[model samples]
Target chain A: MIEHLPALIIAIPLFGAFIAPLFKKKQSIAAVWAILITAITVILSLMLMYQVRLHGIIVYVFGADKPTIVLPSGYKVPIRIMFEIDGIGAFMAISATLMSFVGALYSYSHVKAESGLEKYYALLLLLEVGILGMVLTGDLFNLFVFLEIAGIAGSALVGFRNYRGEASEAGIKYLIVSAVASLMVLFAIGILYGEYGNLNLAYISRQVSLSTLDMIAFGLLFASFAMKCGSVPMHYWVPDAYTEVPAGINPVLLVSTYASLYALFRVSFTLFANVSISLERVGWIMSVLGVLTMFIGVTMALVQKDVKRLMSYHAISQTGYMLLGVGVGLTVLHNSDALAEFGRTAMAGGIFHIINHIIYKSLLLMTAGALFYVTGTRNLNEMGGLARKMPITTLCFIVGAAAISGLPPFNGFASKFLIYESSYRLNPLLAVFAMVTSILTLASFVKVFASAFLGPPLEKFENVREVPRPMIVAMVILALLCILFGLFPDVVLNKIVYPAVDALINVAQYQSWGGLA
Target chain B: MISKLVTGSGYWSPLLWLAFLILFTLIGYVIYSRGNPSYKKESEQVKPYLSGNAEPSKEKIQVRASDIYWGFIEALKEYYKVLQAIHTGDVRDYILWYLGVGTVILFLLVGGA
Candidate 1:
């Protein structure tokens, strides 16, 4: 039963997406189906994670052929498009599902106010299907296919409220950029095939011999994924697109970015594990970009009048931290023989931050959504003293704020602490820059909290009331999870983080899986 | 060997050239700013005389955000147009275009392989 959890996770939402359109005129029925689908997917993802932890790696083939092939070196590779689960994939899947679940829960009341509820729910489900498939797929081309699905779905969802010119414009911009990025990725994949004729990740990993072609392919692929992940220079589209999307859709968009960034690591490390890919270059590029991204993103966030845009910039900044962790790991991988251990530390930190980002960022987006639900605006300057009228919303928003700012005993701090500690051990300068960025982030969120929630009551919001129970329930669950993950970092580390780390560092494991030595 | 070295060095040359170009721009801007009396006199600054009486407003004379990078974005506007042109409100056109692109990519992959 557990063995088929991977397929089930993807299938439920997919089936729901198809079924949702049939209930086009029946909004209530569609909502119930979407909820049921998301709930089942979340439970399945949890169970899958448990199974993967109990076992080593849950490697399931789509269409199995020979059991395993013995190479000249007697290493056996499984012959199929594998849906291999390690800690990272499991954790990402769970976080994505959980957020989707919460987002759906919050949407019942929030989405009731909007028109085209059918298309909205259907696109959301399709977006989930793409995300799940991207996380689970082991083939590079399959990953690209899933990437396209996710990108198109995201753009459609972003432009869901197409009446607004800004939404349409932002969605168009996102679409163009996404298309170019995908093309570049496809070109890189072409180069890889030319160099080593394989599309399966394991095969590529086995056959990858360092060359100019390999390096160029790495650069192109990395750059494309970096753009998709909203890293420094290529991040201009994120804030506009995220902010312009209908309020309920913000969390969905954030999760899409989260999933894509994880895809970057998953694909990159799997393919380029052993090549002399210049970790120093990769590190400097990522860390420098990360520092600038964090600084610029947070600074821009500070002066933003619109709460959604502010949170959007902060999303860009959070990507910076994750990049910094990965960069530190890459840097250490080259300079020292303790590469695997230290790299794991950095990767673990990065993965932890990714999970933490999903929780807090969604909560914050939901905060924005909740505000929009009542006040009909996302501008923080227009909001004030909502702490009295919308106490639960304000509390949830504060928890989100605290987590994002990386304050003590919050999920953000735990993951960020690991990133900082690991980077400090590798290179203290990056560590320093990371610290500064963290402080700036804290400052920006503080400004948001102060301006939006803490000031004297605005006359406009005088009659504003709290959102319904379901939305509150969603926020409360996320807030509690934030604290839970923060307090029990070791539990998360032991079950999820460590196994992912082990999988990443173990080249032999990859080689064995790919039938290459 | 010569081609490899040339290609390798070619990458850095542009970066170096860019550095110099930026430095020159900075120096020019500084000298211009220093020499021009209008730079210091914010109150006296008027919209550049464009053969007509410039309208007065409280806003400072600065390029709007959209206008600042209009050229770069305008260059890419064609792709956006192409995308928007495909918005025929028909799902069939989108599928056809996707099929076309996908076929090209697949051909490239197989042929390149």
Candidate 2:
């Protein structure tokens, strides 16, 4: 039963996704069922994380041969794709499931009047399947397949409001860029295959030797992953796409991108372990990019009249923090002297920031969605004194804003403090720049709060009321979790987070978990 | 020689850098004090251009969305035209670009041997 847990975690959603399409004639029931499916997935992921915590890494292989017939030394380790869960994978899976669930629940009313509600629900489930698969899978090729699934669903959801020119335009841009990035990844995978002759991540890790070809493949793979992460120079489509997407859909896209980033770390560690390339140089590049992205995104967001566009720019800025953490970790990992201490600190900070970003960013986006629901507009200039009508949403948005701006006593602040503390300890200049960015982020969120929640209540908003009960429930749940994660961060860092970071850092342990080496 | 002088980590380079910094500071100070009058004008001219008769009230001024950003995007209209022409929007063109770049990469990597 425990062995099947890994596959069930993803399979339940994948099956529900396909079955949802058949219920096209009954959109109402299908939407409820879709919500139920995501709920089940969230529960399963919690159980799965608990299971991984008690036990070690969970590995499930396909096509088992009667108690696993002993294989010869030279023979391949059975061609089955793996779904292994450790600390990071579990955290990502839980986050993805929760976001997908909330996004699904909100969609009940948010998308009720749409033409193809059934199809929307189905794609939502499919996207959950893709994200879950991306997080849980222990194979590179499988990761690519799931990436494609998520990408297609994301593009479709972006274009769901097909009548709007902006929607169609954003969808097309996302589709083109996503397709190009995936192709770049596939081409890199092809190179890895020709060289290593295997697609399993652990096996590839053991086999890959640092070489010119390998380095080139690594560079291409990094570029592709960066594109997906919406890293600088490749971030043009994010604001437009996120702005055009329905509020209910924004969380799914945001979480999926972070999930992809988690996959990137796993694959990168596997392929580039002990390579000649300088992880520090990459780290420096990432730090500069993070600095640039944070300032630019916030400044642009400040100028936006549309609430969605502002939130979209905030998404870009949040991606900067993640890059900063990961890059610093990689930089330290590249140097032997700093590998033992600084590397762990940096990597932990990075992983912590990833989790924090997921929480606060989703909260912020959902708050925006809730505002849009009540006021029927995404322009902050058009909204005023909504705090009086939607008190719960106002509280949630302020918490999210405070957290994102890295204020004290919130999940965002805690994680970002670690990042700033570690990065600054590593290099004072980088830390200073990061601090400046954090201050600017605070200034930007203040603008969001003032324009959207404060000031004289617009006349048009006189009749405004709270969002639906279910959505409020979802938002409150997220808000509570954010506070819990903030206050007792040690629980998360020690139990859930460390194991995940350990999973990536300690390749030997990963190898021993499976029969890869 | 200029590149060498700039790149070298020597006293001469430090002197050159200091000279450049001083020059930049002087120019920046001047610019900050009097650089772009348009910015100053925009802030001071928040009241609709009165032309000395107490400009039209806020209720009379209508602002539209299209009036923003498109102007900057339009400033480089020729470049945008070139960009638009190159972007065929066909899936095949995207694929071709991907494969062409892939082939070139492969050649460089394998050719390195």
Candidate 3:
């Protein structure tokens, strides 16, 4: 039973998604089913994370003679699909599952009033399956498959309120871009498959000769995944999609964005693990892109009036921090001692930021949703003195805003501190710009807090009240996490981040899982 | 100490930071309390006033969120022009930008390699 846990993790939510429509008329019942299934998925993911923590990497081969069937002595390649659940994959899976679980809970209140909830829950589960599969699958094509599933489900869910032309418009844009990006990924995979006859990541990594075509394939894969992750210059669709989606789904969708970022890291660090691809040069390109993403995203965020759109832009900016950290890690890979010192710290900073960003960004988005719930307005100009009316939501927003701005004693500060301190050693400019971005982030959120929550009370909102109980509970879970993760950085860093970093930078660990040893 | 992270370059211990924050805040409060330490909550005194003049009604005095950053926006007008021009929100423009970024990445990674 334990041996089958990997496949079961993906299967359970999938089966639940398929069975969801059976309770279509009973939205409440379907909601309960969704929550129950997602809770089980979360438990399974935690167990998997724990097991991976105890043991280094647990490889599960599918449809083989026994689950861990070693290939025959003559056949060196692995033909069957497999799951390589290392610390990094498990960490990301745990994040994806936790966010999805909270999302499912929040959806009970957020989507109950809306129609077609059965489809909503189904799409939500499928979305999780996609992200989890991308992070967990050992095969490259399987990543592409999951990428498409997530894109389709995300697009459909984005337009869940099709009657609103805004949502439908955003959904269509998402679908078009998602399809184009997915095709590019498929094309890149095709190039690699043509060169090397296998689609398994470990197999390709072991045998990657890095021909001219292979380099082009590498470029294609990076571009596609970067686009999917909402990197700058390619990030216009982010504001539109994030603003139009249901609030509860935004946090989970945010996970999908990070999944793409995870894909970016995996392709660079794992798929092209050998010397042929020139890690330093590729890493520099990513770092430059990261700087551009950071500056452009924050500058644009500074002037936005719609509260949700502003947060989305900030989300793009935060992604820049991760890119910078990991990019530096990639840049310094040629130096073993440096990789051990600054590079590992940079990578840890990037990965730790992923956890921190999920906690605070989702809470911020939910708070924005709570404001929109009671006021029916996403415009900040229309808001005034909400702090008095919705004290809980306002408090959550303050915590979220402070954390996101990298204030002291919050999760963002701890993660950003790591990135800034380590990346500075690599290049002082990287650290300076990161700190500058942090200040701008604070300014941006202060503008939000002042306009939306502070100032004189509005007569129109005199009778307005706090958000629903479920939504508040959903937010407080994250808010408390913001405090805990902020105040206890050492715990997460030692226990979670280091192991995940090990899973990433140590190519030998991944290769050993491929039966190379 | 609990909740502390140490790297090669520096260390962050929230316990110590929190302790200092509490200490400083207490001293500041005590010092400030030596002056006007207490206030009465009177609705009439809480109304907005500007330069010893009666302020406009709250509705009339409402500041548009967009207006909050006018000074910053004015100083960076040219920079914002480029940003806004690039972010035209049109499909063709964004697609072209995507292709352009991909092209640059291809040259940098592949060409250099």
Candidate 4:
């Protein structure tokens, strides 16, 4: 049973999504059922994490007589579907499942009054399945399948409030963009299949020769995944989609974007690890994109009046720090001295930022949702003096805001500190841009705190109260994690993040699981 | 200790920072406690004073969200103009940017290869 935990994690959510609609009339039961299903998936994902930690990497072949049989009988390479759960995959799985669990909990009270409770919960579960599959699957074609599932479910949920024209419009835009990106992914997969005749990532990582077609495929995969992850100047759809997504499930949707980011890193570090691809050139490109993403995201966020839209732009901006950090690592990939000096730390900073970003970003979005729940609006201009009415939500918002701003005693600062220290060694300008972006991020959140939470209490909100206990619980879970990760950065780095970075840079271990080495 | 993170160039210890923060906070509190006792909340001294002029309504005095960064926006008007213009919020334009970026990446990779 433990050996099959990888398959069970995905299968449980897939099955739960199908049966969720059965409790259509029983909305309360439906909420409980959804929470229970997500909770079970979270537990299974944790079990899988522990297994991977105990046994290095777990390769579960779907059609083989035994789960460990990567090459059956006479076959030279793995032709069957398989899950390759390494350190990073396990790390992302934990993040995705934990986020889905929290989102489910928050949705119980946030959307209970809305109609279509059944489909809403179903789509939420499907979204989780999609994210889990994307992070866990080893086959390239399987990744494409999961990407589509997540894209479709995420798009549907974005447009779930169909009565509002903006919601429907945002949903349609998201669907079209997702379809195009997924098609590009499929095309790239087809290119790889044509060249190597195998869809397994580990197998292909061993077989790739860096041909012209391979370069084209790598380009397509890089651009498409980067776009999916909401990097600028290709990030136009992010604010529109995120601003309109139901605040309850917004964090999960953000996790889906990170899944795409995982794919991007997988393609760069794992798929092309052995090839003599121009590491410096590629790294520079990524660093440039990171700088642009951070600067533009914050500038746009600073001018926004809508609460969620501002955060969405900040989401794009924060992604820049990750890119810059990891890009610095990639730049020094071949130089062991530079890699040891600053490159590994930079990558660690970037990787560590991913988990930290999800925690504080989720807390921030939930607080935004709580504000919307009470005020019936998302416009910051329409809000004032909420600190007096909803003290708990205000405190959560301050934690999230301070964290995202890279203030001390919060998770965001720890990751940004790593990024700043390492990126500065590569180029002073990179670190300077990062620091400027942090300042701008602080300014943007200050705008939100002042305009939305502070000031004299508005007459209309005199009767407003704190959000429900469940929403508070969800936010508190993430808020505490923010502080925990901040205060004890080395524990998380040594236990979780370093293993992931090692898994990415060390291609032999990934290939060994598939008998490719 | 697990609380200390040593980057290649430097180190960060949030626990140490917290300890200093607590110490300073306590010191600040002691100083605050010895300050003027005449200051009181919900008193006439707490009311808004507009340079000895009549005070405006609460709604009028409070700065709105858009007005918070008026000068900053004005300072970067040229930059914002280009940014806002590019972000037309059109799906067609979004696709164009995607294709444009894709073409550049393809060129760079193939050229480098």
Top candidate (DockQ)? 4
All candidates: TM-score: 0.79, 0.81, 0.97, 0.98
**What is the full ranking by lDDT, best candidate first?**
4, 3, 2, 1
Better of 2 and 3 by lDDT: 3
Off by over 4 Å in 3: A70-74, A514-517, B32-34, B49-55
Could you tell me which residue pairs clash in candidate 1? none
Q: How well is candidate 1 docked (DockQ)?
A: 0.02
lDDT (10s digit) by residue, model 4, range B1-113:
43798998878889999999999999999999999898778776867983677877777777789999999999999999999999998999999999999999999988877
Clashing pairs in 4: none
For model 4 chain A, the run of ten residues with the poorest summed lDDT:
A508-517
**DockQ of model 4, rounded to 2 decimals:** 0.84
- Docking outcome class, model 2: incorrect
Model 4 lDDT per residue over A1-517, tens place: 9988988999999999999999999987888888999999889988887887788888988988988888888788889999999999999998999999999999999998899989999999999999999999999999999999999999999999999999999999999999999999999999999998999999998887768898899999999999999999899999999889898898899999999989988898888886655767788888899999999999999999999999999999999998999999888888889989999999999999999999999899899999889999999999998999998898999999999999998999999999999999999999999999999999999999999999998888888999899999999999999999999999989888998888887778898883432
The sequence of per-residue lDDT tens digits that candidate 1 reaches over residues A1-517 is 6667777788889888888888878897777777888899888998988887776566666754422222223434433566666666787788778877887888888878667888888888888888878887767787888888889988988887888888787788778777877887788789887876667777778787656676666666776777788776567778778887766566667878877787777655667776644555556666676776776677556556677887888999899888888777666665555455465577677878888888898889888888878888887656667788999999999889988988766788778877776777777887787788788777677766766677556667789999988889988988998877776676777777767766665655664553322
Candidate 2 per-residue C-alpha lDDT over B1-113 given as tens digits, one digit per residue, 9 for 90 to 100: 22111101121222344468789999999889885656554464655455767655332332323233455446756755654454454545544554454455345434443
What lDDT score goes with residue A369 in model 4?
90
The top-ranked prediction according to lDDT is: 4
Which regions in candidate 1 have their CA more than 4 angstroms from the true location? A65-80, A334-342, A514-517, B1-113
Q: What ranking emerges by DockQ with the best candidate at the front? A: 4, 3, 2, 1
Can you give the lDDT of residue A103 in candidate 2?
Answer: 85
| Candidate 3 chain A worst ten-residue window by lDDT | A65-74
In order, the candidates keep a fraction of the true contacts of 0.00, 0.02, 0.63, 0.83
Instruction: Sort candidate 1 into its docking category.
Output: incorrect
Better of 2 and 3 by DockQ: 3
Could you tell me which residue pairs clash in candidate 3?
Answer: A410-A486, A411-A486
